[model samples]
Structures are given as C-alpha cells and as structure tokens.
Target: MKELSTLCYIEKDGKYLMLHRTVKGNDVNRDKWIGVGGHFEKNESPEECLLREVKEETGYTLTSWQYRGIVTFVYGEDTIEYMFLFTADGFEGTQISCDEGELEWVEKAAIYDLNLWEGDKIFLRLLEENHPFFSLKLVYDTDDVLQYAALDGKRLWL
Candidate 1:
C-alpha cells in the first residue's frame, strides 16, 4: 500500500517536540523517536493533514510552519509511504498526552543520541542545515535496516 502522511518538527528554544513510539504494539516505529504526524484523511491536502495531525498529537495550533521536504519510504518493497515533512517555528497551545507514545521536547543537538531510523538522521540533518525543500527516498529491508538512500533523485552514500 502506498500511504500518504505528514510529519512535523515543532520548535521552541532549540528544542523540537518528539514522540517516542512506545505505546503501540506491532508498530514499525516501536522504541524509535520521531516527529509528530499521521496518515492523511479523506481528500486532505498536505497542509490540511499537517495542521490536523499536529493539533491531534500535540494539541498545538501551528502559527507558522514551512514545508521542508518529501520523504519516500520504501519499506520491504511493498509498503511505501510518502511522508510530507515540515518544520514549525511558531505554534500556540498546551501540550497533551499522545496515545501513540510519550511526548518530549528534545534538544536538537541531543537528538542523535536517541534511537532513530537511519534515514531519519539524513533528513533531520537536512532540516538542521536548513536545506531547501527536497525529496528523499529511503529504502529499508523488512528488518527496518536502511538499504539505500537518495536525495533529489541522486543516490547518496549509505
């Protein structure tokens, strides 16, 4: 199945809101740290999905956000997910508990210390470097090991 989704990194004081995926069973992202977002609802645009997902996951209304990139995830050949990536510098609302996992504001510099998808490290670095809107393709084996990577159509060293 080709799934469409959105993921956002909301920033405040050098920290980004992160979700530790520990709550769900049989979750591909179990025990991994990731940004907030989810699959698109019926006829929802990327922006629309982003806004709704952020509110649902963090209880925050985004005041300002930028589309960062598109990540094409090839999970074991058949499970492909095109994830719309975003970075938000402005938002307003109180945080809430997420049923998907525990939420925490993690320092950007310390993020690498956490357990993360290998492909995520690449895109996160791009986000940290303020790279322009680009496309990243990450192919992973059934075991979730990153097998290949590309940026803007060019293959990257794994």
Candidate 2:
C-alpha cells in the first residue's frame, strides 16, 4: 500500500533537530538518524500533518516554516511512500522526551557523521544547497541500497 508522510527539519542556532530511530523494533529507520516526522493520519494535509507531528514529537508549535519539497520513495517493490519535506526556523514550546527514540540538536556540519540512508544523504544535500522546491524520487533495492534517483524528473548521476 502507498503511504504518505511528513518530515520536518527544525533549525535553531546552527543545528537541526534529529531523531534517532532506535526504539521501534521493526522500524525501517532503526538505528538511523533522521528529521522529525511520521506517517500521515487520515484527512491530514501536509501542513496539518507537519504541525501535528512536530507537536506530538517535540512539543513545539511551528510558527514559521517552509515547504521544501516532495520525496517519492520506492522501497524495493511493495512499498511506495510520498513524503512532504519541510524546514522550520520558528517554533514555540519546550522539548519533551519521545517514545520513539532519542532526540538531539545535531550541528549542521556534523550531520553526516550520523547513520543515515544513502537516499537521505541525497535529499540532505539538496536541503543544504537550498535548492528551490523540488521533487525527488529515490529507488532502492531490496537490500536498501539506492539504485536510482531523479530530481525534478531528470535522472541524477548519484
């Protein structure tokens, strides 16, 4: 079944809020560090999902954010996910512990040191480059290795 999700990189100072997905036993992101997000709930738009997820996971109400892009992930053969990507620089609230895993404010320059998916690196670069709103498609093999990638309908070299 196709899935819809939202991901947000909440920025503060020179760091981004990162989630270490180690709590879920069967999580596809287990042991990997990623931005805050989750699968969409019924009837939730991208913005709604983003807001709800950020609050539930971080106890923050976003006051300023930008829609960064859309990512289409083709996982092996059975699962396809459309994820809305966002970046937020303004929010209000105190931090809270997440049941999903550890949350940390990772320095931008050190984000590469974290265990992350290859496909994630691709999009992270796009975010770093401050690319305009884009559409990225990432195709992965059964082993979770990136096999193909395209940006805005054009194939990317890596």
Candidate 3:
C-alpha cells in the first residue's frame, strides 16, 4: 500500500524541535529521533497536513514554513510512502506534552548523534545545505537498512 505523510523540522535559535519515538511500541520509527509529522488525512493537501500535524504533534501553529522536498520511501516490496518534507522557523503557542513521545529542542549539530535512519542523514544534509526543492527516493531492505538512494532521479553513492 502507498501512504502519504508530512514531516516538519521546526528550527529555533540553533536547535530543531525533535521527537524521540520511544512511546509507540509498534512504530516503524521506534527508538529513533525524528522530525514531527504524521500520515495525511483524507483529502488533505500537503500544506494542510503539515499545519495540522505540526499542531497535533508539537502544539505549535506554524506561521512560517518552507516546502523543502518530497521523499519517496520504498520499503522492501510491500509499502511505499511519499513524505512531504517541511521546515518551519516561525510559530505561535505554548508547546504541549505529546502523547507520542518526548519532544525536545536538539542542537542541529548533535542531531547526528541520535539513532536515525541512514537515509535520514542524507536528506538532513540536504536540508542543512538549503538546497532547492527536490525529490529523493530512499529504498530500504526488509530489515529497514537503507540500500539505495537517489535524488531527482540521479543515484546517490551514499
């Protein structure tokens, strides 16, 4: 089955709001630190999904955000996901406790030290570089190991 989702990295000062995916027992991202987002609701546009998810997950309404890229995740032979990526620098509201996991502002440089999917590292680099909007495809084995990566149809060695 194919799924559509949105992910947002909210930046403040020199840190990014991150979620530690430890509360969900069956989560695909269990124990990993990742950006905020979730699956798209019926008929929701990317921006709509981004705004709703940001609010639902982080309790912040995004006032300024950039549509960063589209990421296609191929998981073995069973599932495919198109994830719309975003980054936000402006928001309003008091942060609330998330039911999904603990939320914290992590130093951008220290994000790499956390447990993350290998393909995430690649896209994180792209985000850091302030690259133009692009498309990325990440293929993973059944074990969730990143096996191949491509950006805009061009194969990436890493």
Candidate 4:
C-alpha cells in the first residue's frame, strides 16, 4: 500500500477552488471535478505537497491551510492509497488550466451537483460546516464503495 496527500483550497469568497478533470479513462471518477492536489513526492510534507500541487495545477500559492481529513481507496485484491486532505482560505495568483483539467470556482452551495466520489462529498460537507481542523479515515471496498469512516482531533457533526 502507498500513501498520498492532497490539498483542498477554498477561496475567500466562500467558494471552493476545484479542478475539473478532463482525462478520459475507465476510472469512474475521471472527467469529474476534484480538489487541486496529487500524490506527494519523496520527503514532501503534507503542506509542501499541497503547495506544490496547487502551484503546479493552477499556478496559485496557498496559505493558512489546515489538515482536514484522510481517505483510503481499496481496489480489487491488493490496491490501496491513502489521501491526505487539507483546506485553506488564503492563496495568491490567478487560476490557470493544467494538463489535469480546467480550474473552476464552484459555488459553495452547488458543489453537490458536480460528479465527485460519494465519500468525498461527505467530507466536503464537513468542510463547509467549519470543523476548523480534523482528520477523517474513510475505507472503501474493491468496488469503490465506502466501508467505514472514523475521525480524530476534533468534533464534527458527520
């Protein structure tokens, strides 16, 4: 199993900064909207991973970020990846498109309309509720169905 880290940057206008993935593939989540982030390279901290990813993906510099949650995906017999999720309210630079997809500012109220992982929506809702900082561990099965979820470090409604 390998672990990955990602950052979810929220803009100051109460909108979420997201990436619209246009990659065509068999992955069910492809061609969908996702957070601006990716897997971390060697020796990269979660913050470093996020800053680099945001810069690479949209040319923005993020700040005042806080760890929010972790999600795990299990595929088939032996595939697993842990995703570290973070949130931020401050950033610099204008948005730019990347090879991954187009960058968009999704309104806070309409985020549910976009195509996103079911478990991700849950965490997104948590972020909107202003949980401050916390960690969520979500387990998924081979079929990409959620199995369980647990949290630590803060109290959340979900």
lDDT of each: 0.96, 0.95, 0.95, 0.75
The TM-score obtained by model 2 is 0.98
Q: Candidate 3: list runs displaced more than 4 Å.
A: none
Cα RMSDs, all models: 0.6, 0.7, 0.6, 3.0
Using all chains and alpha carbons, the TM-scores for the candidates as numbered come to 0.99, 0.98, 0.99, 0.83
Q: What are the per-residue Cα lDDT tens digits for candidate 1 across 33-84?
A: 9999999999999999999999999999999999999999999957899999
Superposed Cα RMSD, model 1: 0.6
Which candidate number would show the highest lDDT if scored against the true structure?
Answer: 1
lDDT of 2 by residue, 89-115 (tens): 999999999888999999999999999
lDDT of 4 by residue, 1-158 (tens): 66676757566687888787786556455777888888899999878888898888888888678887676555555666777778888888887778877788888788899988777887887787877565666666766676766666333343
Better of 2 and 3 by lDDT: 3
- Model 4, residue 84: distance off in Å is 1.8
Off-target runs (Cα >4 Å) in candidate 2 are none
Model 4 accuracy (lDDT, Cα): 0.75
Tell me the tens digit of each residue's lDDT in model 3 across 1-158: 99999999999999999999989889999999999999999999999999999999888999999999999999989999999999999999999988899999999999999998999999999999999999999999999899999999999996
